[model samples]
Target: MSNPNYDQILVHIIDYVYHTPITSPRAYQRAHIALLDSLGCAVETLAHSAEARAFIGPVVPGTTVPNGFRLPGTLFELDPVKGAFDLGALIRYLDHNDAYPGAEWGHPSDNLGAIIAVADWLSRSQAKDVTMETVLTSQIKAYEIQGIFQMKNAFNKRGLDHTILVKVASTAVIAHLMDLTEDQALSALSHAWQDGHPLRTFRQAPNAGPRKGWAAGDACTRAVHLCLMAKAGQPGAPSVLTTPRWGFYDALFGGEEFMLPRPYGSFVMEYGFFKLVAAEGHGISAIQAAVELAKKLQEAGEKVSDIEKVTIRTQKAGKTIIDKTGPLRNPADRDHCMQYMVAVTLLKGEFIEGEDYADDSPWASDARVDELREKMVVIEDEQFTKDYHDQKVRSGANAIKIELKTGSEVPEVVVEFPIGHPKHPETLGLVKEKFRVNMQKGGFESATVEKMIEMVEKDDLPIHKFINLFAKEVPLKT
Candidate 1:
């Protein structure tokens, strides 16, 4: 008989992923769109900074594995471990992938690092067809695993970064992707639980830095490593989560047990929101409110100098994650700051972009941004907080109220969901635009971009063909 002491959480996840049948056509279509969206994010991030490329590719030059995993936006074919880091970091570099908000906030698409790496590697090394259909099914499963755990667990509250879920979720799905046995899957997941969790300090004040951008990638790399070890016959930690005083729950989760709101399925990818603008997820609605207020200011023939004070009301998650004061350190710092996002939108009277947060960008050093940050006040709206946590609503609500020098207040503009939410049918066009623009930004030719759109739009494209299209390398400048 199987050991009765195996961690139930790991067992349940493995069984669901292995046993569940994806019967919903809507789920498959959503996953396909998400794959395209995430690849767009990866391509765009390639131009963010050369620093990102340092962590990708083979550990040494000219050490390529035959039929190895191909990274998107480059020609490097590497072992799955390094490939996961490359793809994961690229997808998350700009924080532009899909997000699902609840008790915890995370980019569920971050798992694409491991999902794509292992799937591509398997297709090339093994004889599996690995169609786009297979990739979509795996993507949906990974998103569900991560999103469901996020629904009820407040990892940030315990001072741990939310990417812990990335490691766990990726490990489960990647093990399945490699076709590991149930015991090997169990061992792989057990190792993920034991891996040290990253502190959220890099994501917070006075110390915020670029690590936040690549932390998910690091988690993805580790998840792949664990899966490989398990396949090599590593022993499973049967009680990793429930061990007395040392388990994940007691040690890292503040002694509270995990609360899974529902059984695992395709619900998360079905409802996940893509970012129309490349900013922190919590601050998107606030950015929208600010943009509306800016339009109103323009119509009233008002200048940004006419603004006396700015008040922002948002969900508690927003206040916890993005609220910041004092000197903004870098692009990472600026992007995560609520006041900075609002200031740029109100001052420029346009939607913010990833380049806007660059350290050398004029906006980063603009005195007016600091001026607005000083005049801003952020508070939590109890109802917005409640609605954000409500399963049915799950709205990332925020309201912006600006006061003029004339002692008159601009009408408070509130947004329950940002433009990218699935509820807004109009955003489909915008997401398509974002994909095209990002592809060009990543240095692909216009014809290549058109071909990518054509190929991805087709329902019967094979996964290996899609991967090969992305494998075409851009010529590096001498």
Candidate 2:
């Protein structure tokens, strides 16, 4: 195979994925928790609809291997490429996974599809053997690769989905997990860089739908495919980012190279915020602020329907992403709309969950929701936007205010950090509760749930055994 001086970006990613010591026990602990939490998110999505159930499993019916990689919360066992797609899609199905805020916004746990699938498959099929500890280490590295890149690269600004980072990160780490040399890992990552990215159009109005949910999973699947091709001696394009007029820098990135805000480490996974609610990450703080506003209105015996106007003050990212109006096409549209989230919470006096945004839900048909959304005005808060991008103060802040017809107004409720922010003290407890609820919804037995938690707590558990826990057949809605 042809090998040239690799791009510095690929070199940094390869070296870190292969050589990082990951000495932080806390990092590993957090990774273990993230794994369980991702699985919980996967299981929860399994019940969303039978259509979701149809997306996973062996590509062809009755296809079987004695030790194929098992996707969590289902009985599917397949080649790692397809398996990665399945697990990645499931974790991201509800957009409820952990998030990192930066110039670009993305869910870093989206890499787990390739990481877990390849690790577990290697453990079952090869002699070197993999372990949950190994998976956690790779998980940390993947999160760092994706999250660090996310810190300053605004992919959405280029109309690209943030899953490009998912593909790059997954390819780098999965190459390492497959026991490739560092050079091979670099080659694999270069291939990933050369791959085309999906547009963000599917995530915005006029076409927003389920593609946003599966986009990251699709990236993870492609990453695995690229790594495997690299392993098979496929050549990589070393100048994919820098090559003249056709390179990513000039052609796609507006001639700007990626910015590295920090060195890669376990930092992202450790500090990445979990989602307690099922809405888009940008809208979480707004949802929190709206919930608080609803409580005050209740105390005063006021009604949201009587509101003369509603206003939302949010970070620039929130306004760019979730601030929406007009008819929401589907769950994908509703969950990403800041107005929809806050309006629903104000009307119901409760946090919005994944199911609440379903196209057929009562909230979708409620004229009150649309009415409230119509009365809402969303604006960017400069300070909130500044704090959101600040390394030392990474907060997704939002403020909500309502003016009632009676000429009285509820004081604006501002939330600097939602419940799942790393700075929030109760984040861990809330995450565990979120996981428990999802697991129970998946119809997993209490004993099985306890065992899964035990595995995450223990170090160095064999990967095959861990994968086996999720192999039990669960009934799917027909």
**Per-candidate local distance difference test:** 0.87, 0.86
TM-score of candidate 1 versus the correct structure, residues matched by position: 0.96
* Model 1 C-alpha lDDT per residue in residues 1-478, reported as the tens digit of each score: 2234688888898888788888877787777678888998988787765656666778998788888888988888898898898899989988888899989899999999988988888888765667667778888899999999999988999989999999999998888888788888889998998988999999998889989989989999999999999999998999999898999888887778999999988999888888988899999999999999999999999989998999999999899889999888888899999999999999989899988888888999899889988999999999999999988887888999999999998999999978898777866677878888888887878887777777765655656677887865642421
TM-score of 2: 0.97
Q: C-alpha displacement of 340 in model 2, angstroms?
A: 0.7
- TM-scores of all candidate predictions against the true structure: 0.96, 0.97
Which pairs clash (backbone N, Cα, C closer than 3 Å) in model 2? none
lDDT of 2 by residue, 1-478 (tens): 2234877777777778777789887788778788889999999988765556877888888787667888888777788888899889999988899998999999999999889888888898874578787888889999998999889989999999999999998998898888787667777888788877899999999899888888988998999998888888887777788888888899999999999978887899889999998989999988988888888998999888779999889999999988888899898899889999998898889898888888778999999999889999999999999999998999999988899999988999889989999999998888888888898888888888889888787667888787788765755654
Candidate 2 residues lying further than 4 Å off, grouped into runs, are: 1-4
- The reply for model 1, stretches above 4 Å from the true place, is 1-4, 457-460, 472-478
